[model samples]
Target: MRGLSVTETCFAIPGDIDSPTGGYGYDRRLLTMLPSFGVNVRHLELPGTYPAPSQGDLAATVDTLNSAPPNSTLLIDGLAYGAMPSSVIEKINRRIIALVHHPLALETGLSERRRAELEASERAALALADKVVVTSPATQRILEADYGVAKDRVTVALPGTDPALRATGTGTPLQLLCVGTVTPRKAYDVLIEALLPLKHLDWRVNIAGALDRDRETVAALNAQIAAAKLEDRVSLPGVVVPATLDRFYESTDLFVMPSRFEGYGMALAEAMARGLPIICSTGGAAAETVPDGAALKVPPGDVAALTKALESALTDKRLRVRLADASWEHGRSLPTWNETARRVAAAILDIPT
Candidate 1:
């Protein structure tokens, strides 16, 4: 796959690229790592805005596809496909494949109109693709149920954590880490509310991720924290370097993500790899990723439920031990990036050479 021309269409790469918006962080890593499995990848950056790929942009994309070499395999990441035009997707080369993290329409906190548009775009892309790779069984179910894609067209290739994230050494003041963009979908506010209930516990919550998309939601969460007098117990450290994040994971006692929805919960997997106990909402693919008994699970947006789970993880020594053991065992089963790339390559090649 390293030398094969693997064209990727994605919403954005890193900020260093032509894309105006920064990425979800995984795209850049995948772009660099996929080549190790023999994929000679070319990234095509799409616009940041929703209802993406205007008429002119669609025409340009079609022209590019039409001119590409015969048998060139186009890899369309699901995020970019959801924003693109149906007509544009229809013109995609027959050798194209799709890697679906999740359906954009199911993402939390989108306008109904936008959701409809995204769903339509996804339907078109699914129809055009020769194969589709999903990250979880839950997403595969959605693809079949909602998009009406044939079961044979879809394959599950779970995302893997970076090998660099592992337990380093113990530190004082148990740190509870949550990493993801600050947004309504992430349910940072719900975490804050849960934290308020556990103020008596001697622990700190540090959330590090991009914050531009949810300034208002973040501000409201700050106000809630202040009102609850949890200023000293919680910190929004914003985005941190990989080294810094690994350090946090090493020292952190627990990882919590109370997101209303998640496609694959990559951060949770990273935490598990680091041997950190987890507390996550059983929404979307989270339930599948965070196996039963491995992590405390709560209903999405249920403040009381999250609060209780947080309290248990913070105070119960036996529960923590159980969680740690389960998490470590589960983490060990995760596939490596090379494995993921190989699976993707096999899907692309489809038939014996």
Candidate 2:
């Protein structure tokens, strides 16, 4: 496919675009950045009840999509796109471009019936897209292998990272930071268990992200912290503002993400952007997202392994410095938002009318 081109496309995203989650952040940035690269994008805000929309919301999704300019290409966010009825998907007049952050079936904690349903629905939805854009290579592979999408039909556009200042630790209690919504998939329970054994070490853990997304996970994590008597050492400062989050990145000594799966670890990339040493699990695209020297990789959901890595990172100065050095060097070369938009625009332009 050729590079960036001048083309009009419609991006239909479910829910509030201002949501503070990684997937929404990706979409927000693309909406802001794609236009500068010659891809004229018109935003369509679908009903927020997606991934499990009611019958009425499903009909609204179809109607909203069908209302787009007939000549414009329709780019649908996978959150809603994948769940659309195949019959309704075929009714839209515009050429379809599917942007999949990750397959919905890969999400943690789904029942067998729901998982099977999502798998079947997504497989059907993706087939109608003129082109598919995935946030990571791992996701691209998953679609091709499991969803039966052809290799040539998909494009891998890694998330873009903004430049950040290097972090300088607050040495008295080395600052540990984890960024992600408090969801079951994020595996905060595993993180809480892992950090339990390391309380004696000089570290204060701050989990920064929205807590309201999953009330059960939040309650469970709080219970774990209370039971472990880590209430003083660990804190969940939900949805830190941009200024405070920047301060967190600036002062953090180490970054950790123990997600059960990641389409692409945007938080990890943000950590690396700030030259912070990382400890993350090898789930989905997480392992490949951070280079070996840049992080202490552990198997996902392995509380013991995560605990060991945490202890080592906390106790050893040399390891943190070495990893940070690798991270700093790599961060300088990460793709910019423009590049991300360019790749997507190329995919959009590649679609045959």
Candidate 3:
């Protein structure tokens, strides 16, 4: 950490970096900025079937890990690393650091058996790493307290937010936006139910995320929207481009995320960066991300509480403005990509190689 010495490192991540999710976004941005801090980061695209890798995927991952340059550190995305067998993890020759967004066992809608299996595998996999880098303090605690990682071996490198044009209020029909995948973890069903009571209110919601990832959830959401007679007001524009996403942030009156859990709520951070009032559940790192009084937060899975918050956000213009102002003020204080890269680079440098 004394000098900005260049350190070569290989970062293995799942699927595409372009995937419209917080985890992928964090990886892509970190890779893009690490070079500025004298870290030579290499990208290794692991198989898509991660966190439950098939035998073939496991074999491919082993081959990839075996090919890393000697003395270079291996920084594996936790989605892949947490599911890898302990034998594979233990055999890695170089220093290995896990970049865990959150534990996979905490994902909603998993069977108890699958959850237990994930918990055990992740605990084993994490134990094999030389060090662990988590995105939030919440996840750091989870690893140390629950996964048996030593306190001294864990580091926190929070996700950074890009600056954005302050969101302008959309008059008449309030424009609501929720950014995240259409998965059970996001709790879209609760958001829909929360909105169900406010159909008479003038609001148009745009849920932008990868709808293809979870077809069953998409189908269920569509049916729920249809059943609630809100198809016209609610639209799911799947996996929007960056420019389009920027437009959504710029034009939105309120940004909402009803996630059941998050390691660090990047979407919530992005929303704050854009100066939009928020209504999100305090599931995981969400409360840590948004400052108090900047947004209306409720406990996860509480449809009634969400409904009440939505009613206040939609009907009370003064409250909305106040929330927006607080959000803008807080957003101005968020860390930039440079800072994020610096902290990550420092952590990487601190890792014994």
Candidate 4:
């Protein structure tokens, strides 16, 4: 079979891709792994915000598409579609696949005008694409119900976990880790509030991510931590390198992602891969990401429920063991990048291009 070639419209492979905007992280690991399956992947970086595509931007995209080998596949990741010209979409020589991380309009707490703009842009993108790829069944349903995307046109491709996150140690203080940008959508404030109720427990939280987007929310979270006297108990260590992140995973006893919404919690998958027990909210795609018994699920924005779950994880050794075992099972079953590449190749084969 001929190898498949794919290009993405944002955060290309082997790049320094970090965002302070609570956006997802795409790393070099994917670039290194995908090629093993005979798939050639290229990432194209685009501007951050949207107001429809400018002529110059559209021209650049057209040039990129024209330069691609005939029969190659192009995948536009989320907002990239909104920022590309309709003429470019209509004239592309290769098959077009769009990956919707989430409906950009539904991003938590955007103003009405901005939300409407995003919705308009997303609708245009969906209409222009030949096929759409989503990570979870929940997202598929959303696309069908909200965006009016036909079920047949949307493919569900689950994201893979990095194997480098395996567990290495068991130690004291029961290190709990939360990873992601500090933002309102992540509900870091709720996590902080929940920790207040568990002050008597011997657990420490290490929140690692850049402070971005939600400045007000981040400020409130810091204030809450200070007011609750959790400065020593909870540390906001900011962004760390991949090796340091691995060290955190090795030392971590549990992972908590109290997000109000997530398209697919990549960090949750990474933590589970490391055999860290999980506690996440049942919002967006989280229910699909976390397997039963592998992670505790709670209603979004519920501080009391989060507190109770954290306390249980800290005090009950049996629960921890159960979670660890379940996490191992869940992690082991996840598709590797080779598998992901195979799936992408299969999808490309089905495309008429």
The whole-model C-alpha lDDT of candidate 2 against the native structure comes to: 0.90
Cα error, residue 112 of model 1, in Å, equals 2.2
Cα TM-score per model: 0.88, 0.96, 0.96, 0.84
Q: After superposition, how far is residue 237 of candidate 3 from its true place, in Å?
A: 0.8
Best by TM-score: 2
Worst 10-residue lDDT window, candidate 3: 1-10
lDDT of 3 by residue, 237-330 (tens): 9989999988888889888889999999998889988788999999988988998778999999999999999999999999999999999999
lDDT of 4 by residue, 123-149 (tens): 776887777877677888998988889
Cα RMSD, each candidate: 3.9, 2.7, 2.7, 4.2
In model 1, state the lDDT of residue 123: 87
Residue 35 CA displacement from its true place in model 2, Å: 1.6
Best by lDDT: 2
Q: What's model 2's TM-score?
A: 0.96
Per model, how many backbone clashes are there? 5, 0, 0, 1
Instruction: Return whichever of 1 and 4 wins on TM-score.
Output: 1
Residues 80-162, candidate 2, lDDT per residue (tens digit)? 99999898888887788899999999999999999999999999999887789999999999999999999888889999999
Query: Over the full model, what C-alpha lDDT does candidate 3 score relative to the true structure?
Result: 0.88
The whole-model lDDT of each prediction reads: 0.74, 0.90, 0.88, 0.73
Off by over 4 Å in 2: 1-7, 351-353
Candidate closer to the true structure by TM-score (higher is better), 1 or 2 = 2
Error of 3 at 178 (Å): 0.4
